[model samples]
Target chain A: MNSILSIREVSKFYGSYQALNAVSLEIPRNSIYGLLGPNGAGKTTLIRIINQITFPDQGQVFLDGEPLAPHHIAQIGYLPEERGLYKSMKVGEQALYLAQLKGLSRAEAKQQLKYWFEKLDIGNWWHKKVQELSKGMAQKVQFIVTVLHRPKLLIFDEPFSGFDPINAAMIKDQILELKEGGASIIFSTHRMESVEELCEHIGLIHRSNLILEGKLSAIKKIHKQNRYEIRWTPLNGTPAPEELLGRLPVIGPHYDAEDNTWDFTLELQDSEKGELLRYLSEHGNLASFRERIPSVNDIFIQTVQKQESHA
Target chain B: MHKLGLIIRREYLAKVRNKSFVIMTFLSPILLVGMIVLIAYLTKVNDNEKRLVAVLNESPFFKTDFESKRGISFVPLHGIGLETAKDSVLDMGYYGLLYLPQRASLEGVTEDAFLYTKDAPNTLVLETLEGIFEDRLREYRLQQLGVSSEEYARVRMGYEINTATFSGQRSAKGINEFKAVVGGAFGYLIMMFIIIYGGFVMRSVIEEKTTRIIEVIISSVRPFQLMLGKIIGTSLAGVTQFLIWIFSASLLMIAVMLFLDIDPAILMQRPGPGGLEASLAQSALSGDDTSQLLVEEFLKIPMGLLVGCFLIYFVLGYLIYSSIYAAIGAAVDNETDTQQFIFPIIMPLMLAIYVGFFSVFSNPHGPIAVAFSIFPLTSPIVMLMRLPGGVGEGGVPLWQLLASIALLLVTFLAIVWLAAKIYRVGILMYGKKPTYRELYKWLKY
Candidate 1:
């Protein structure tokens, strides 16, 4: 895969405190990369370095395979976590001003702003002061300004914050659309569900270190326990014999008295799924069977907990 | 550089389009001129009010001396004691009762004379009463000396002293005081502009920092570029407002002069009230052709040079001070925290005005004035204070003026360099307030 942005052994420090310690990551082109971390885990530091808000104390950052320079700021869009607009300024004018600041010509800025405003159904709010808009409406304006420059890389820190569910979904759709249009995005959020829905690649940062980094599916697969859940019922109104149940490779079995159903989880160890299915056929009627894969949330929690306990 | 232009444009448009800016730009000059006109008219009206005074003269020496004038009308009381006269005066609603006691000598007559009123009479009324008594006494004394009152009056005129320099250059007696006052006014203007516009730049910085728009802005533009753009943009707005004030004030002054049917040259010839002219008026009246010389001396002032220097100093002074103000704004989270940092920046400006005025007024060529005028921190004000005196043996040297300007320019660049460092680091800092030591560390960063 071609990486649009490469952070190589970048480190940052604030006074005596280390914000990022030898952190490195490759953001693939046209992919949504989730940056996962607890508060103050250096996600913001890395993002700021990429946006050139602040520079790393050591190491280097490369954008499009070139050493980062100030001019490269035009190629990246940043929506900070503490997002705001000038409250007294008219929405359209302020947006136009910011877009022009990002190296867009006035005509191009106006055209892009118009298209975005129309798409977001905020065309009527062009002349209204930002103070007059609801928080969600102002967020829509901020989002529009961030993307109006058509940048090659977009960085959004907690983009879904302060957004209602409907607006969140709308923003989510827009982000996906931007990615589809060939823009690489760095998505930072605490919402694992959204990460699962949106991000293709992710880097898990803990204590200023990137502990896990890869494709989302691959990471989950590497951490998988190979556990399967089974639901069985008696065929002749007789329970399965205890001896037959003992012969099966199972970890925990649960019985439901109200429905007369047997549910159990099995860990595959030197046993094939087809053999287990054949054994269950002579004992009882198999209702359902499915492999259980750990969710992103579970993996995140487990990884963080494991690191904390080790520390 | 292009982004700097965009930033400046954004700042300029934002400020110029503000409603408060528009209103203040137009309204302040009107208010200032209106206040002056109101005070002048009110004083004139107060002087025109007529007051009645009842005079009870027990002395047989003077009866016709207490004649009535335009604003004060005197009524004689016959065959009435001082107490009855006072009662009748109060009952008749007179403004005051002037009682002249029977005395054998002029000195005793003054000691015995008393004026009683419901309230303390103004100095004008008191001086008028005293003048009448003195004139009568002088006439009586001249008759006793066997000389006519007219001859004595001619002889009583004071002697005049003509002033000139050792080089035989005919100079006005009070020219230094006049030039000092004029220069002081220019200095005061520079001080006022720095204070007002420096606060403006600081407030603009604080507004952007507080609103969190600075991050988005500095992402595209360097912090130094952003700071310079804001300073230049706001100064342009300040210049616009100042120009409007000057235009409107001049127009209003002209209109007022026309409405009052007063000569513009007369207004220019005499400095305003509380000026050196008021103190010198007595000496000027005693001297031969002093008013004409005073007017000539005022005209001899190098107004073109003074105005040019004022513009240069105003720009340089504002640039130096506003950069510091911008740094303070970046270093702090709010205006309250600015107090600790602001005092040091403004101390020199305030000191310049106070020390410049005193030193220039007393001795225009004194070392203190020269030192302050050459020091970059105080030069904008002190140099203007010395400009009207002219450069040579008696005033500021041309080399000193150029050096002051050069030093101010150099200082401005150095300050901008230092301030940019603080601004770059401080704009993103939140929560913790910074100290002077911390700011020093930011310089290294």
Candidate 2:
């Protein structure tokens, strides 16, 4: 797939402290890519470089196969982690100013801002100063300014932060809508749940190295273990399932006295599933069977731990 | 170019909307002019000075009319000797007794008189008496000399110089002083505003750097553009205020001038306070006094030149210093850090104004004066005061002033160059104390 944004072996240093070390990543077009890392893991440095806020010491960044330059600044929208909206400025005015700075004509910016205002239902806040808004409400205004230009690439650092669950869900829906309309977003957040629900593809950087990078489903599958839980009931009053018990590795099989139901974990040990199923059928009726798949959080912790332990 | 226009518009609108700027602009000139008028009004005519006389002559010739004005209360001492009159005058509340001794070759009792007092009279005291005595004496002379007032005026030959220079310049030798004083004050005020407010602009830049707003702005616009915009904007504010001050000051000045007893037309028409008429009255009776030797001639001569020089210095001087201040602002992040840089900027302004004060009345065209006035940094202030008095006359060539102005322009450009470089970097830097050495390093980058 063609990459919408590319950083080729990027490395940056701050007067002796290394921020990013030969980090390469590609964000595919029309995809929501999660840039995952712990604090001080060069996530912000890479974001800043992509935004052209600072130049990297030893790397190049490209947008849509072209080298990044000032004019291209108009093509990318950045909502920095530390939201900086002018405190005393009215919300609508500030948004228009920021939009114009991104190279939008005043009339066009106003038009786009009007639609955003209506969509976010913040039309009443147009005349209110930003300082008067709560942190979450201001975030909505900031989000509007960030996307007012309809940038081809939007970088949101901690986009869901300071948002209540309802607002968070609202912003998530808007992000997905933007992504659907052909915008590629680099979503940076330490919140793994956000990554799980929002990002289709992600690159996990632990200690300045990319430990895992792939589709969300594929990554989970790569780290999956084959383990299943089974719940059953006896057909009659007989507990004569000796062959089935011997063949299967049952972790725990306890009968509930009140319900007469047996629940147990089954681990396959070189035994064919067809043979095991026939043995179980002679003694009891199987009520339920399901495999436990690893969650994204579990995979993240495991990968980070593995890398840290090895290092 | 459009960006510059946008920037200028922001400055203009923001400053115009500020209430303090509007109020100060209109108030300062009014107060300044009102103060001048107030001083003139408060300077009341003295009303309590009595004179004692012990003229030894018993003849009516010794008792010639000594017409008195408001302050003078004259006491006659006919037939009294000088010693008795002096002693008697001390007991009374009189300042002194006039001691007129007889002269055998006199053309009538003549007119001049002398007085002794506890101390020398103040200018007001001396001026009042001198005016009254001269008026009465001139009448006596016109009669005794067998000449009408018109014939005596014609015969006196009133030495005049319809002054014309080699350059075909016909000059008004009169009111030359008043013009010089006005010009010097004008130049001084303009220079003062530029320096004081220019520093404000620099401080504003430093404040922005301290706050780190520069990073956000510089990301969008070039560093040079931002700094240029701020400086130009602040200067425009100052200019607006200055124009308002001038308009208001002129109005106040006119109002005050109306109430002042100082009409140039009136003062000019009347005989100069204590000059020819008083001197003639004194010399006619007391013989020519010889104590007027030490008056500085060149110091008082060219009021016109000083005034002309002041106008040139005011604008050029302000522009020159303002550029440096702007550069200094760009070099540092805060006022505390500016302490080191400030000395270099302030020393020239201080010296120039100090020199201006002295050069106003001293040898305005002395070699030292010429050097300071032409020196680009100090010229704006020094030449303003010096030019009025014709200091260093032939030495002050046109090319020199032009050269100074040209040099100021070049210096302005250089300041902007170095300032822009530092402004770009310094504004983005946070939480660091910038040293002089570090500043140099930033310039290199």
Candidate 3:
């Protein structure tokens, strides 16, 4: 896959504390990349560096395979976690100002802003001060400005924060729409569920280091335990034969008294699905057979907990 | 540079469009002119109050000496003692009573003469009474010297030495004081503008920092650009407001003059022949043409040079001080924390005004005035104070003005460089209020 942003062994230090220690990341073009970390895991540090709000003490950042320069700021959009608009400024005026700062012409900025305002149904709020808007409405204005320039790379740090669920879903849909239009997105959040729903690729940083990274499916596969669940009802009111159960690679066998069925979780141990299916069929009438894959939340918790114990 | 322009435009619009800014811009000039008019009117009314004095004279030497003038009237009390005269004056609501004792000789007539009033007598009344007796005593002394009253009167006419410098420049008396006043006014304006507009810039920086919009702005433009843009934009707004004030104030003055049916030339006239000794002496020197001389003296002032220097110094002073204010705004999280930082920035400006008044008035070329005028921090104010003294031939030397400008420019650049660093780091920092040490550390970064 082609990469739009590549951070090569970037390290940042704040005073005596190291914020990012030799952390490298490659964000693929036209894809949603999730940056997941606990609080103080250097997630904000790396994001700020990507936006050039601050610089790295070591290493380099590249955008579109070119070394990042000030002019490249026009191609990037950032919605910081702690976002705000000038409270006393008129909504439309403030929006136009920000858009112009992003290298848009007055005519283009006004035209694009008109389109977004109408699309968002906020057409009548042009002359109102930003302080008059509700938090959700203000967030909508902020979102419009962030995406107004049609930047190639969009960095959203906690974009959904301070939004009602309905608005959050709206922003999520907008983000997806932008991604569909060939914009690469960096979605940084601790919400694993949102990550699972949006991100195709993810990088997990722990204690200033990138500990796990890859395609979401591949990463899950690598962390998978090869566990399967099988439910069966004994035939002729008899339990499965002891010899058959012993021959199969089984770990825990549980019985459901209410359903009068036997549930067994087994380790496949490199065995084929066909072999497991055949063994289940011969033992008893197969009720249900499924592989148990870990959710992103589960993977995140396990990875972080394991790392903590090791430390 | 384009982004900087955008930032400046935004800042300018934000300030100029504020309701309070517009109100104050127009209101201040009216208020200032109104205050001047009120004070002048009250003084005229006070001077018009009539006072009645009753004189009880027992001496036959001077019965016709007492006379009534514009605001003071004297009445003679016959066959009444001093106490009776005082009581009658009080009962009749007279302003005061003047008693002349029948002394054997006129040698101690002034010392023995007395004036009594219900309250403190007006000093002008007393001075007038004393002048009558003094003239009588001088005539008596001149008669004793065998000089005739007419000859004595000719000799007693006030004499004023015409003064002219070696450079053949003749200065009217009190011209130096007038120039000092004009220079002080310019210096005062610079001080006031720096404080007012510098506060504007500081508050603006604080507002941006507090609202957290600075993060979004800095991401697009450098911190230096933002700071410079704010200073320049706010300054332009200030200049706009000042221009409007000048236009409105002129209109208001014209309206007032027409309403009161007063001549504009009379407004420009020097103080009338009243309480001022200088004007009285001037009238004694040239009875009717003192006002003409005053007009000529005013014309002699190099107003063009004074105004040009004022603009240059005003701009340079504002840039230097406002940059410091911006840095302070960035360093503190709130206005309250700014107190510790603000005093140091304003100390030199305050000191310049105070020192400029004393040294620049007494001797413009004094060591203190020259030092403060040359120093970039106080030059904007002190230099204007010294400007009226006129250097080289008759005005501020071109080299001194140029040197002051060059020093201000160099200092402004250096300060802006340091302030930009503090602003960059401090704008994003929250919660913790920084100390001087931390600011120094930011400079290193």
Candidate 4:
């Protein structure tokens, strides 16, 4: 796999309290990696290490096959969770300043800022003070600043927060567009729906340890049980047979009186699936049937709970 | 290096562009000049009001002793009784009544004399009245002993011992103290600049932390660079303000002197309340040689060394103090939490000022002054107070001066290193109010 960033046995501590404990992961190139964890489970700390805002106690980080150093800061864009602009400064001036700090020349910063401001439909806000912008508008400005230099990697901590649904979707589209333009992304958030929608790979952190890290689809496939949902309507006015259903490994059987159909869930092994299908055909016509897929949210809660129980 | 320059530029612009800074820069000189003018006018009005004392004398001894002077006038009442004198004095709105009854002897006349007023009389007025009585009694005693008035006047003639340095140059009394005071003014200015601009550094740090901009900044530049940039930038703004104040105040002083039709040279030589100028003026009235020597002595002070040391101490001292300020700013989340840390930082400066003035005035070469001047924290101020004395022989010793500068530079570096550590850790920390113990822990980090 072509990886854009990799961490190996990175650990950090604040006095006696360990923030990260030998945690390690690789973020694939041109892929969105969801860094999932409960609050204060070392997600921010690890992200800070990646950004070089703080160094690790023990371990090394590499970006694009090279050791991470100060120069790599220019290659990464970080939108911290607690982010803001100089409230009294004009939007355009503040953006230019941030861009310049990120190693862009003045003229280049101005040109890029102009393009982003127009692209975000906030061109009129260039001369307005940041204090005059609403929270969502400010988020948009911050997003533009984070991506202005066209970094090789982008890290956003809860980027959707403080954004309304329509703006949030707009930002989501922009993130995908940036991915299409070939930038690796690390998304640290508790929102599983966005993760399900955007991430191709994920790492779950619990108690300062990476409990799971792999392709999102592969993890889901490994977590799924042989559970299937079935819907059928009785033909020829035949009543439902409770004994046969009870004999099988069936759960949550419900009969919809308006539609005259039976809805139920069944867990089956590979060999027993053919027998169940034949029985279902004889008893009533099979309306619909599909295997149930465990969502990222369910896997997250279940993994964390199982870890807690073991501890 | 380029990023540090950018940080410094931004910080300087932020401070200079602030409205309060601009207003204070322009308004302070006007306020200071107005206050000085008001004080001078008030002193003149106070000096103009002469107290009137009504003298009711039944004795023939003190007939001519009640002559008027600059601040007090006495009117003699020949036929009025003591009660009538008091009533008339009150009716005429006079300051007081001085009653002298007939006595058989000079001492007896003074013993019976009494001065009464509606309230406790002004001490100065009372002293003048008593001085007249005392002088007359002395004259009377001398006359009884067969000394004539002219001889008595000769006996009471004032005298002052001539003073000169061992180098055969005439030296006025209080000139050393005057020089020390002049140097102390520079020292005092340095302290104010450190405190005022150091406070700016601290508040600017706190502002960035509170606004959540510090992380973004430090990510682009080292925390040490940012802290140092802030100190240098804020001090530059302070220097700008100081330059404005000095320029405008001099202009205002010249205008006021011109409006009053006063010569600047005469004003410089004018006798102040009590100082080298007063004593020098007294001697200058007698001979041209002494006045020329006075001007020579004033010019002989090592002004070049004083100014050079001032710039050195100003930069180094401000760096040391403001780094601590920046550290404190980073350790806390808000301005209110800074109270606990500010006192220790200001204590050394206050000690330098008060102790420096006292010791440097009495004995510039004293051990106390030398020790304080060599100590890193207080040296910036106390050392300047001694620099006006010159360098090698009578002024600050060369070794002490070198040691003071070396220690200040070292202390500045060490403090900045420690401050940067705390700042690096603290800017990212939120919510909790950090303690000194926590700051120490951060230093390790």
Candidate 5:
């Protein structure tokens, strides 16, 4: 009941090539779930299945506890990685057409489109052909159309591409705002930085299989390795005491002779952080100490590379 | 259902609003009418050209036999030798020189005659000269046999076999050919419309794929719905253009002919002696009964059935062809790649037109015509060619007509189904140049 969408062992094939293989995942309601995968790793295929653009050759998908059907299309919004509006159509007209196709009435589509266009500060572009719009401008229109129907679940693939940093930040804010409005989102992208900033939960797919899935922080915690980095500088030009730091199972220790400073990383056992802190303080002034957490990017690369080596 | 309507409306508006589509829709009729008018005027001028042949007669025969005709004139050379006559004819830029040498008998004189020209003489002019010689020789032979001139005249009269239907309505010569040509013109229009607007459907699919908007749209509507919408919408635009062309072309043709005081019947002529007009005129000169019978035969054509069948065939034929076009559009990334796939789609339509005209015009009930008219792919063109003769009995059998339409419907459904399969996969595919084998694989997908 807590999950807005659930995919159960979905499998798909294109002729002899298998595009998806027994993949299963769930997205909790009102959370931004990052769909992370390398290029050609069945991420697009999974999203397409969710959108009902294509059906899985073998499996079942449920949206809001009901089997996915044509009616579910109005409840899901998908913005593909490669997206476009009709080039010859007027911006507002094209937006209205797409909205209507998503089950909005003409008057409803028009009113909603007007609200979004003004909110996005593109009110004057209503009559301009899409061909005349700048790439970012067109992206803005696409974004509006995607969310216009106010679907229960929104899927965005590479949404930040072709946008400047400022616009990207603006879009990022809008995405946050949509999520705040209680719409569950499936964010698919190769950019890991965006995932770290935005995603609360994630599913990592590699080679047509779900290799990893959990809360982002929980996954990072599991891969923590109890690793920590410490930096210290000796007081009053005292030479660095490498014997004490080395005896503490320190790794890659560095000594800056000019500044009389030392830096190194280490894996500490349970209840051993106090002992390490005492050793560092007794030897030199401790500059910094922090646990090293693996980023989503690191986890993605490690998982994919591990799978590649195994294959 | 609603989404399909929206897609159809959008597609229709997109095509109709396109600059080239609008230009071609209006401008083409004018170009067509202008071309026909130009050809008719040129043909008139060509037929007006007079060919003068100098006749150097050194015999006491054919004194009044070499008569001047509409396009060929004979000028007798007086007190001139053969070389002098040739020189004068060449100097005057005459068409040719006809020399008749003196002999003891008319047979000897006729045998020694020659018509010499700077280049090869025209076949029509040569035939005219030979006809005159044939008549004179016949008369001389009759005189030698001691037969009276009255008896010779009775013997020389031309004979024509009488014709009638079982119902006793007289039939006219060239009416079958005439009806076939008229129906063939309708068939030709369908082919052109299918090719032109079918191209519109194809290009529209390519546009959506290349723009990468197909994925977004399909996420809202089914791919089959989108493909069907495109074909229907584009064909509606085509039908609109076709109606406008027929209306405007007819209006413009009538206006041009009236303002210039030209006879359209003359335009129908083939522009030389022994042409369609000449033979029809000859038959008319024999008696007015034949011309009246021809007019009745023209009116007896089942215009209502022909028109009704035309609309049916036009829709079915275009649907079948454009679905294939839509699939091709989805399979290719750009227009250039379409060249590899376009020929096969067009082959059936071309075969329909060329084969329909040949087989239908010769014998409407012939095996070639009957088979082509029921073959579904070519039926739209060939069936109309035979329908002008009216259905049942002498015309196309009722079973054949129904079968042709029924087969077209089945074929259209089958093609659209297969095409939708390919379209679903191909629109999402990018960059790769898909072979026929790949398309076949997509059908399975």
Candidate 6:
């Protein structure tokens, strides 16, 4: 698949302060790409550049193999972090206006809005003012507007914010539905759970540089700790688990005295599952066992912390 | 083109639906008409305070029961001492009192010598007494000359000057002065609005930038298009509001006609000296003759010219000032920060208004008014006001006004360029206020 959005060595500067430092990344077509970072880590700056809100000092951006131009703006939909809304405007009225700005005709906008409103069960809100809506409800309106014109690429910054879990789930499903229909997405958020649940690819930005990025599963596999957690009967605490403990380094070996269950974390010195399994079977009764794969949240925090301490 | 149409439609709908717009349009006419009626009612209520003064003829000359217009009545009194007179009048609760000297010594008495009340006597009573004294003095003088007052009146010589201003050209005279002042005043009002509302547009842009909404919109629309769309949209809204105002004013006039004695047709129909009929007559007779003192010449401004100049100035001046306003808006984050820039824009407009009032009076072709109006920065308003005066004494030369318009256009373009530079950078800025150096660096970017 073609890279729906590609940033090459993009460096953005505000006066002498560098907002993004030669950051380069690729978002493949039809993927839920998570742009993960701490605050002030240049994620917003990169997003802004891709949206064409501001120009970068040294970079070229390509959208689906075409050089990004003014005309191409219609092909990209954006939801800014601050929530671009005219407060005095009525809800459906502004939605139609913005939809037209995004290149939809009035009739088309109304038709699409009708479908979205019914789908979200907010059809009654059409005549109401946006200011009267609760923050979560307004977010629904904003989210609908973000995807209304159905641009080939959609960029959402903290899209799930100000939403209840039910609405969040609804919007999440919609986002996935968008991706399935071949729309590329750049989802920026501090909530790592969103990245874990929704994103198929992830990029870690720290201090204005792309520290890490890859397919979600591939990145996790690369950072895999080769550790496992096992809960088993310890043979009445007679140190009968030596045969299991022998094959691997016992990072954590503890026993719940009341439950009479033994728990231990082991790291494989080498990728030899046969040896580890054989040792476990010989020494302890295998109650449960599972590999401890690093989560995107853990990796994000670890990556940021590593860079901070290293710098 | 489609986007512009969309913007226009949105702006029109939003403005027409705005309660502020509706209320302002209807409320202004009500307030204006209500104020006129309120004034009339207040005046009528104050018309009933006639002073009832008591006069005793101890002087043996002046008459009692004298009348003084509708606001003063004198009552007869029996001879009384000064102290008794004062106490009786004060106790009686009269508006005021006046005492005259006896007929023998009245010659020695001065107009200021009369005294009775603690405060100044009622003006109506004083005028009546003054008239009596003057009549008596005149009769005494006529007796000394051994001539009757009727004979003296027959011998008086008086002549009135019938001067009419005409130099085979346009001329200003008499009530034309008032008309000129009024025309200037109305033109000044229109000018002030363009400046005020145009500045509002600029401030709105800066506000949205400060809030960061401009950033999201800018992604799909260029800054120039956004700025242009907003300006055009807002201007159309202004005109729309103005039209609504005119409509409401007519409706109010109709309401006043139907419900009250006030005639709406009085304004519409020509009546008496100051009527539009007289104005038309004055100009129609001055064919090929510019020195006509006719009210018609004073009203000679073609409606086309009036509207043309107004539209030209309204749009051109608004664009010019709005650009500077946008620049100021982009430079500052909040309204407080705008104080530094507001004065420059406001002062020139005010100065133009003042200059316009004096344009037709002292020097219709004076350097000050001409200069102000011919300068595109101020011309849109001042020029429109002076156009009724026939381009001024020298009548503003066509080239001069056109040049001003051209300069205004260039200035408008330049200001927008600079404002856009600031806006492109300013929208994403927050927390710390930008310094002059930082703002300057943004232009470099």
**Which model scores highest in lDDT?**
5
Tell how far residue A135 is off in model 3, in angstroms. Answer: 0.8
- Give stretches of model 1 more than 4 Å off: A234-252, A258-260, A270-274, A285-288, B54-92, B97-121, B131-155, B166-168, B260-288
lDDT at A241, model 2: 36
Q: What CAPRI-style quality would you assign to candidate 2?
A: incorrect
- Which residue pairs in candidate 5 collide? none
TM-score of model 3 vs. true structure: 0.91
Cα lDDT of model 3 by residue, A1-311, tens digit: 39999999999886667889999889999999999988989998898888887888899999999988998888999988877889999999999999999899999999999999998789999999999999899999999999999999999988888889988998999999999999999999988899999999999999999988989999889888888887787655656534456645355566676776877777777657788678768756898888777888998899999999999
lDDT of 6 by residue, B1-445 (tens): 7776776576556656778777887788888778766665554444556667766556655553255545566765677866687788889997656666555654544343364666766554565666666655666577688988677655432322244445454354443454446457556756667675676677667657654567667776776676666677777777777777778777776687578765333343332232223334544434433344454665665557666777767776777676667666767778777776678788878777777766644565578866886676667666766665544344567776677678777877777788778766766676556666777888877
Ranking by DockQ: 5, 3, 4, 1, 6, 2
The B-chain TM-score of model 6 reads 0.76
Candidate 6 accuracy as TM-score = 0.81
lDDT of 4 by residue, B390-415 (tens): 99876778999999999989998888
CAPRI class assigned to model 4 = medium
Each candidate's lDDT (Cα)? 0.84, 0.68, 0.84, 0.86, 0.88, 0.73
Candidate 4 docks with a DockQ of: 0.61
Return the TM-score for chain B, candidate 3.
0.89
The most accurate candidate by TM-score is 4
Quote the lDDT for B87 in model 2.
75
Residue B401 alpha-carbon offset, candidate 2, angstroms? 5.8
Lowest summed lDDT window (length 10), candidate 3 chain A: A240-249
Q: For model 2, how does the per-residue alpha-carbon lDDT over B263-351 read when each residue is reduced to its tens digit?
A: 43432232224534655554443321111111233344565665565555555555556655666776665677777877887788787
Residue-wise lDDT of candidate 1 within B195-302, one digit each (tens)?
888898898888888888787777777888899999998888888888899999999988987798644443233322222233345444646577678788889898
Better of 1 and 2 by lDDT: 1
lDDT of 1 by residue, A1-311 (tens): 39999999999887777889999899999999999988889888788788887889999999999999999989999888877788788999999999988999999999999999999989999999988999899889889888889899999988998899999999999999999999999999999999999999999999999988999999988888888888887665645434466655455566676777788787765367788788788767888988878888898889989999999
* DockQ leader: 5
TM-score of each: 0.89, 0.67, 0.91, 0.92, 0.91, 0.81
Off by over 4 Å in 2: A9-23, A36-48, A56-58, A82-91, A128-139, A160-169, A190-192, A201-311, B44-196, B199-216, B255-344, B355-414, B437-445
**Candidate 5 lDDT, B302-388, residue by residue in tens:** 889989999899888888888889999999999999998999888888998888767789898899999999999899998888889
Task: Provide i-RMS per model in Å.
Answer: 1.6, 3.8, 1.5, 1.2, 0.7, 2.0
